[model samples]
Target: MRTVRNVHARVIEAPADRVGALLDRIASDDDPLFPAPVWPPMRFDRPLGVGAEGGHGPVRYRVTACTPGRSVRFDFAPPADGHHRLDVEPLGPGRCRLTHTLQERQGPGQALLWSLFVRPVHDTVVEELLDNAEHAATGRTAAPPTTRPPLVRLLHRLGQERPVAVPVPDGARLARTAFDRTDFSDAWRVPLDPGMPRDPRAWRDVLPFPVMASEGDELLLGQDARHLDFRASLLVGERDVTLSTVVRTHNRLGRLYFGAVRHVHPFMTRLVLRRTRRRLALAAPAAGSRHRRREAALG
Candidate 1:
């Protein structure tokens, strides 16, 4: 197996010292690299550190070494073979650059997996991590749309998952549930307008687009359009909330639809997360009436 390596880098708008401290305090809160306690379940058996083991979905890795703020490395666990290194370098007084590199040996049939899925997913995930870091340091994150080549676009056309979580607004449970049923759902639920259908031939309008499935904290909704099954689920967690979509193609038409927009999918996912967070922040009134009263009185 020939050793294959890939490197991804991003700049953060924060002091090198701050970024280093932020990376070292890896308690799994808002680390976009780790799965949020939402859908598309991903977990680390324990906290990240030397010898700790964890994986998200089918991906797994074992920490091999660490240097707190400067760098860390993880050796791929069995069934997978690789070394992933994350490091930070100083840029200036209030800025720093970060990099994530993956060097691996394709084992067994791993080469196909790497080319087809792992590599693409890893690319997106690394970018997401950079965004997360910037968000942590400066409260904003963005990059130009990531363009996918034909093969990658074709691969994503059949399906893709965008998982993200945001802090749920206070007393906004009903707002969240209702939003799922309105134009937000319409975005992925086909017609773009699920308003009352006016004509008879509008057969697709008759049934209530499913509020699909719900259990305890999670609520799911979707519409089965002709060419594909467009589905989304919203999970209400004690501390945060999340949504993810499943795009299942029915035939050629679905593939065509997906291929055209697969590149946009990840970008849209980030946009959705940003919007959700902004909305939540706005809707969440400041707590502590005593503090508010003092400011009001002073005014």
Candidate 2:
């Protein structure tokens, strides 16, 4: 058995039909608003349509009922025993109120589990879904969606989890905003430094800590486990640089899992850490040899 959860929202300056169409089109392109919660292009069975089995994750649903411009209902698709409903009603000219409700079946003892375990996870998904809907209805984009790191947590089943990767501003080309200036492109490149210890064979052995990567003038950092976004450009002394990264954690089956962006910087960091450790090990013997040589000469 699953406890029922409901979330309601209002969409201003948009009619029910217009809003409905946007939701229908969500599977077509890579919506910037709902980057992580993506669904593959769908094939509809009817006019308030239902699509075939598709999408990347365990989350799936099929539209059970739809009244164009009025409401839509989606039932459990698979891997989830949940159903969601969306209702749109006119508020005034060029405006409408939208309501969304989510309900799921729970087995015996599920209430305790939901209250103690699943509430937070459900809250996040509901919140994120509403955020995507709101942002899509409005044409504007947040300069920085969030400055906070992605929420990371441990799960009973999955070690540590985070949100999937999402795009952020490219620091190199971004014009200076009043808020941020620490662009990634201009950030210090730790691995490239001559004095830095590096390992050619294994990256983790070289760079133990995380480092940033650049594209054009943009600095990008992302961790898929926590669903966190960090995009800030701080004016350091003179040059404008950007720091943008997302750490996300996804909670499933009462367990948390951890995964960072698999990219060049992380790769380089691992390599550098490995080689540096190796070099230190080899240098230790030489230091002893030198000490013995000096002592022998003195004798």
Q: Pick the candidate with the highest TM-score.
A: 1
lDDT of 1 at 291: 25
lDDT for model 1, on a 0 to 1 scale? 0.55
Cα lDDT of model 2 by residue, 193-296, tens digit: 11112222222222233334433334323222243223322111111112222332334421222232333644443344334433443233221123234446
The C-alpha stretches of model 1 lying farther than 4 A from their native spots are 25-29, 32-42, 145-299
Candidate 2's TM-score: 0.42
lDDT of the candidates, in the order given: 0.55, 0.41
Q: Write the per-residue lDDT of candidate 1 for residues 1-299, one digit (tens) a residue.
A: 87789998888878877667656654353243331221122335677688888755456777789887888787888856778888889888877888889898886578877887768866865664565566666655566534555665555433333334434433333334533333222122111111112221222122235676555555556677787666555544443345445566767888898778766775675555444433333233221122233346789
Q: Which runs in model 2 stand beyond 4 Å of their true positions?
A: 1-3, 31-48, 77-82, 140-299
- Among these predicted structures, which one has the highest lDDT? 1
**True-structure RMSD for candidate 1:** 13.9
